[model samples]
Target: MEIALVGAGAAAVGLLDALATTSLARVRPGLITVFEPSPHLWRGRPYGPDLDTVLVNAPPAIMSIRHGDPGHYAAWLGESGAAHLDDLLGQPLVPRHRYGDYLAATAEAALRTLRANGWRTRIARARVTGVERRGDRLAVVAADGGRYAADQVALCVGGGEPRDLYSLAAAPGYVHEPYPLARTLAPIPADARVAVLGSGLTAVDVVVSLAARGHTGPITMLSRSGLLPHVWQRPSGHRPAHVTAERVATAHREHGTVPLGHLIGLLRAELAEAGEDFDAFAADLLAAGTEDPVRRLRRQLRSVGDPRIGRRVLQETAHTVGPYAWRLLPESGRARLRRHFRLATSVASPMVPVNAATLLRLLDAGRLTLVPDVRAVEATGGGFAVTAGDSAIHVDAVVNAVNPPPQAVPRAAGELVASLVSGGLAAFHPAGGVVPADPRVQVAGDLAGGGPFITSGIPGIAAQAARTADAMLTLARDESSEAPATLR
Candidate 1:
């Protein structure tokens, strides 16, 4: 059997590692080909040198690729003496580079194991341009005119490049898209005024890098919402004492299924019924509900209108439900959870303001500036012209921090749902971004309803890869079982 895996980022690595460790390595696919354009296969753009300050927001314990080994990553850190195991687990942040190294090491180990077993594994250092279905097999075409046939395929392509800066065709300033920060930050005049486009984690990393490099120039971080990420804080142990199946069932019965927005109402009802302080109850509930206390707190903030109420919910949930609260949602509940996210963004939480403190500190220190919004830009004088919101700011460099367009897989495995849909072999998902398949693991990661698969974080990407691998293995096994005796 020929198995093809697309992209060599964290997800791909996880899949490969899982395959290496499993019995499937011996009984299944004769050859495994991985399509990755980067020179460093396991370490993709996120872990590159340009993003030194990019930190993993998850605790090391929950960040490992190995299934059922919650403390694997933390143990790795402790054994390596990178830091004390307690310090590593106690803190809410881990350096992005360390995580990158861990992934690389894991991939290397898997590769060695595969080689030792005499299994054929190939890494194609070229871009995959298209995928086509050919009878019982699939054809993966490379941009450079090469092709590979696979009995199965896995599309694990990582995030696309950063979005363009603005609508202008050409501008004098540099519009950085996947631009190397080391190159951009080196040898700059200390008094230069730099404007960063987004206020998310990417913008934060850039701003923090600039400050660390002794750039005294005024930097402006502009965005649609102008909101930055909240600082990493150690979660305290506090939980809501109330949270029973009866309470949840009661809320669902009364509201006909509660959305996250109704969390406030549910809490209020519970409080009134129990005759207790809502804040105290919420604190205990959240603490008991979530393993990641900080994330639990964030979820509460996301559920309510009042900042105090949100904080209390998060604190209580963290103490009561543990980390499983977020994971315990059923598929229908998950869909509702996604909907609640869209609604929660409108109401400003007190915690939302905390997102900007780092940037604000830089502005106050005169190390960053808020540039006037640009209206238009035109090429002129052999350079480019830029219009701010109301003023014109001309510069030699500009970076586009906008989010990238969605990605599409040119080809998919012979039995993979995405491949079938792209090849007109299957139907598309109702939501449009997914290929129709088993709803649990077969996600669409393309613009047309497939998914980029993972989000913008390491933990998310790792989890997606693991889930995908499990699904693919299961599918392959079921197919093999139903095949002719000779084929099996």
Candidate 2:
């Protein structure tokens, strides 16, 4: 048997690690081929070698690629010493490129394990164009006219690039994507008056990176909501009492679906169990949406050591039980969440205390500004005119930091998915990702839909990888058992 994984990034790394560690791999040691055109195989677009200021957003406990093992990444960090301690968060927030190093090492280690178990493995540094069903097997077509046959395939493509909302890709001094800050930041003049689109984590990255690179001119973060991400508190290690994956699954099994109110009630119960006030906490979170951005950042930085575990509990369970609850939510419930999507995302994907300090400093110094209700950004004579809430501001450079919508297909993978859907080999999920029309072809990352409306973090991606590996192996085993003796 052969398994093909397309788009060798973080998801592919997780899948490969899963395949190597699972018991089923020993029973069915097959050839595994990974297809990725990028020179950085396991880093994906997010983790590729970049500026030192481009750091991992989350803590090590939640960044582990091995499912159920929260310490996997932290242990790796301790052994390698590739990370620096974020004293405020009380955890190591390594550079993105350093995290990429961990991924590459993990993939290499997983490949070694597979090889030791008699499973042949190779990475095809080529982009996959399409997947065609050939009888019971799959033919993975590559961009270089190379084709590989596999009994199973996993599409582990990552999320899409930042959206170019204002059609500024062709505009002078406009950066459509703010990644690999090392490259993107170099072209902009140090004193350029830069306007960064969106007020999310990516925008924070840009502002902080600019300061690190000695950028002195004014920087403005323009967005529709103008709500920056909540700052990460030192984790309280709070365990949920009522809000958990098992409870969510049980509720889904008992009731036809999980209502939004029911999920909120579970959260309330969890907070109550911790002797915390749900209403106060809820009101505080709500106030964040309308509160002054600089004031909020300053307040959050002061509360990094707060003893309250309400946010910590919610953050922990968001990935663990959130996915299960999302699937069980009625369309109305999902819509309601979508209505407050910006706020929810800001809470879920918070910034580290270190970067938050940088932002607060910039805001206090009047070097940075937050513009809300961004209407349009048009290229003007020598700069761009950004219209926000009835006010127009011009800047020399505009940086697109708008994150892609949840489950968005990357440009490179969109064609492959279209081919699969057109050929009836796969079906696209309305929520997101490609649903497997043929179970042999699975999905393992942000591209795999039917979940929450956010990109899967490392822990979530790891969980998906584990499930995909287990499902594919179980299917293979069942088929092998039912096969005729002559074929065996």
Candidate 3:
């Protein structure tokens, strides 16, 4: 096929898996090129191997790279000499790097199998600087002046560059990149107060990392809603009694791309069927002040099951239709979703049990504070001045813990997309990033607008890769059929 898979991250892993197992190979010749300059294969920066207090919000149960093999990572943990920790495998969240270990191991094993099965695969230890159409093929040009010709290019560039919370590029004590190869936080004095922007899981990771490293000084996490992420409980696989895939399909058939509000109504109905409601949950999520809404939510989680059960049902429903739903929506519906998506997703991506426990412990000890949101950040004589809703605080360091905004445009990817779009091989989605003009050029990953399905996590990536590959294979079939017959 002479396929070029750019960006060997989780999305690439998904594509590799698809190529390795699917019958699509019957339609094309076999030669795959992977471009990644990272030291290791599949562990993208987020999953890079490192010893840190940061933990993946998802549990080991759902961490497998293989689509149908849910227990792949759990089994790998037992076989990879970490069997002693098997007791915690069922529900506890493990270190983030363990996922890197799983991914790298999975990639190595899969690549070996592919080679043994008579498939040729090559790795390019460089970055794909840009993609330009050269005659009949797309040229994946590397920064090292290397160019690879491909019948098709699958752009799996992961999430784009992070959006900075403040313009503190030159400000002292401002920790812009919280997750770094080396910890810049160790230099901060133990007694120095800090302000953390955003109260999502990213903020939780930063706070947990600081608290574990003996940073006893106060930390105030500021976010727009002042709501912390929901707590994870044991997962329930049973379909929510009310909100099922059939219901979503039915809603779509009736409403023609269900509005975000009506989808919320469906979710509320599911919760009600499950003997729960979103009244309290909504109150906490919509709360606009320094009060910790998650505190009340956590108490409820301890008493009842995780609030994410209803969310899981709705998320599963979204899996069936969300990718096209976003595009199908009226401008008003899109606006509503864009306005509240983060707040809604915060509850969907829950914090691990231990993270919630650690956060509450810090809060109880008065070392952590959750504020409404950061209004502004400015440089002060000592460090940075952060203004929350009503109070102003100056801290020794300001850590921006906000994750990339939804549908963020990749900083470096802009050039590549521009090249492709200018060449009429791709289209940029106004909601977010680039979309492939033809199935020959595929875009897969967290920046989901370019493909048929949108997703960020491992499962979504795997499915998106498979879908993109299948679509590409279909296009390849057409291309092959149309090629002129020749005798050489």
Candidate 4:
């Protein structure tokens, strides 16, 4: 079997690892090629080398690339890697680059296994333009006019870059993308009054990294909703008693589809079992986004050690049951979830406690301010004028920290997807991502459609990788049985 993986990001790493570890001795060895344009393969954009302050935002529990093996990453870290630990969260919040190292190491190890097993592996340093279905095979087209043939193709392209909402790409003193903070933040003056556009994790990254680099100028986190991500608490290791995937499947089998209220009931039951009031906690969670920013931060900080397991359950189930429950929900249920998507995201993807404490310090020290109800950011004579509701401020520089909408196809991949759609090889899903119409083509990572909109973290992507890898091997087995001569 000839396999082609487009985009050497986390998803590619997972797929490679899955293929290497799975029992494939029965199948004939084949070729596996990975295509990535970035100099850093397997790291993706998020995990690539960046400022040391750009730490891995999620906990080790959710960051594992190997599905079903939560300790894979932690074991890799070992006791010696604890130097990058975050005392508040009690987890090693290593730099993003270090996570990239893990991904590279995993990919290399997988490649070694595949090679030892007589499978050929190659990394093509080029961006994939499109995939065309040839006679009984697929042809992957690269930007440099290179074409590679494969029996199976897995599109593992990661998420898109931050959206330039204010159209400030050409404007002076505007940072279009706050990545490789080493490069983006280097040109920025230490005392430059800066306004980061978005209150999500990316925005938080800018503020935190700035402080770490001794950026003493006034900073503003601007957003329409003016809500910061909730701070992550120390893990309670609380597994849900009610929101299991099996229960969701049972509901679907009995009711034909799961209702939003049924899912809520499951959550309520889980919380009540932990001696928590569902309605009251639910109310607070919903109201948190609109409350005073500093007050909410302080309250969340105080609750980091509260010993309540409600948030822990929600966080754990958000990954495990979220995708299954989402696909099984009725249109009405999905619509209701979309209505409060912002709040749901805040709760689901919270910042680490260390970052939260940093933000609180900046706010209390009068170095940082949160601006909600952001109206517009217009380029001014000297810098930029940011208007948020009844308040306005001028900043010397503006960083575009607004995250792209979930599953927003990258600019480059957009053309590639269009080509596939035109060729009838793939179709776009209403929810997100391009769905494969051909059995030989697979989709993984943020690009896979029909899941929750909040982009899949490492765990979800890892799960998708494992599933895709298995499907590819199954295809190989079936092909071998049908045409024994093809294997030789």
Error of 2 at 246 (Å): 0.5
What lDDT does model 2 reach? 0.88
Candidate 2 on 1-488: residue-level lDDT in tens? 89999988999998899888888632456799999998988999999989989999998888999988888888888945434888899888989999999999999999999899889998999989899988878899998888899999899999877888988888889988788788988999999999999998999999999999999999999999889999999977776779988888888889989999999999899888778899999999889778998888899999999999889877777777787688899999999988888888888889999999999989999999999999999998699998888788989999889998878889989789998899887898987777889888898888887979866778789888988989988988888778877765
Ranking by TM-score: 2, 4, 3, 1
Candidate 4 wrongly placed segments (more than 4 Å): 485-488
What would the per-residue lDDT of candidate 4 be over residues 231-284, giving only the tens digit for each residue? 888887777779988889999999999999999999899888888999998989
lDDT by residue for model 3 (1-488), tens = 57888888888887787666766443545678998887867877688755457676676655666765667777877754343231222464557777777777777776777776676899998877778878877788887888888889988778865557678868878777777523767777889888888887878888888888888789888777777776655657656554544666677798777666766676788777777767865675556234457566557447435435555664444543455455555678766655766655665566776677778888888888877756888898678877877788788888887777655656656666777888888887876767788667988877657322223666567667778768777787777677766510
**Per-residue lDDT of model 1, residues 182-219, tens digit only:** 76666455566566776555666677767777777667
- The parts of candidate 2 lying over 4 Å away from their true place are 79-83, 486-488
Ranking by lDDT: 2, 4, 3, 1
Better of 2 and 3 by TM-score: 2
Please state the error at residue 42 of candidate 4 in Å: 0.5
TM-scores vs. true structure, each candidate: 0.69, 0.98, 0.88, 0.97
Q: Which stretches of candidate 1 lie over 4 Å from their true place?
A: 21-29, 79-95, 113-118, 235-360, 370-396, 405-422, 425-456
Q: Rate the local accuracy (lDDT) of all candidates.
A: 0.53, 0.88, 0.70, 0.88
